[model samples]
Target: MTRDIRQAAAKANSPEYMSLWAGQGLRLANDQPAASTVKQTIDEASIFVQRFLTMRNS
Candidate 1:
């Protein structure tokens, strides 16, 4: 098992190889425009941080 893992990791190091990985959130946003997705994520993150910080202080 470790040998197989090492082989996979070695293949990933090749410059010609590339991985197009995306999280569930990114996959869900695929239909939206890129700019819109970015803005929405940032806005949501800002709101979450604000709420979390306020809660921590209370």
Candidate 2:
């Protein structure tokens, strides 16, 4: 479903992204995380989640 964005943004007004979202009115924000940071965060979260699940199931 295509809808209008009341506020203005670069991508919203850029002709390069005219084909973006296929007119779905959905915007993909640029969020490129650092590889090392992402990996470290994921590792930390995975360990916490594993421990929590194990404790809960005990």
Candidate 3:
């Protein structure tokens, strides 16, 4: 195997690999349906936009 592949495989097999590499945001992510995730993201953006517009208008 190539050096990069060997290093990746070794990292994948290590116990500390995920804990050392994964960010705090990783815990908030889920294996949900793509469409559902997209909808939720859009809904969150909509709420933020609404609040921003309201603030600008006031």
Candidate 4:
């Protein structure tokens, strides 16, 4: 809704950010754990981006 959130959504949709998120998945797949803070931030970012897209579409 806010400009900051919309900006984050755009950044999250970028290829570099997508690759970074995907890398986290690969780390998990390999049984490597990301730092707690990194994991939490990424998880929250993912949720925000998903919800942002949903709201945008509606």
Candidate closer to the true structure by TM-score (higher is better), 1 or 2? 1
Report the lDDT tens digits of candidate 2 across residue range 1-58.
2233323334477554233454543364246668976887899999999999999999
CA displacement after TM-score superposition, residue 49 of candidate 4 (Å): 0.1
Best by TM-score: 3
Per-residue lDDT of 50 in model 3: 100
Model 3 per-residue lDDT tens digits across residues 1-58: 3666657767789543333566789988899999999999999999999999999999
* Count of clashes, each model: 0, 0, 0, 0
- Report the C-alpha displacement of residue 44, candidate 4, in angstroms: 0.2
Query: Scored by Cα lDDT, where does model 3 land?
Result: 0.80
Model 2 TM-score (2 dp): 0.43
Q: Residue pairs in steric clash, candidate 3?
A: none
Q: Give the alpha carbon lDDT tens digit for every residue of 1-58 in model 1.
A: 4566556766887433344456677655557798997999899999999999999999
Question: What order do candidates take by TM-score, descending?
Answer: 3, 1, 2, 4
Model 4, 1: alpha-carbon shift in Å? Answer: 47
Segments in model 2 whose C-alpha atoms lie over 4 Å from true places: 1-6, 10-33
Model 4, which residues run further than 4 Å from truth?
1-34
Q: Local distance difference test, per candidate?
A: 0.74, 0.64, 0.80, 0.69
Per-residue lDDT of model 4, residues 1-58, tens digit only = 3566556767788443232345456555544467876887899999999999999999
Best by the lDDT measure = 3
* Per-model TM-score on C-alpha atoms: 0.55, 0.43, 0.57, 0.42
Candidate 2 deviation (Cα RMSD): 10.9
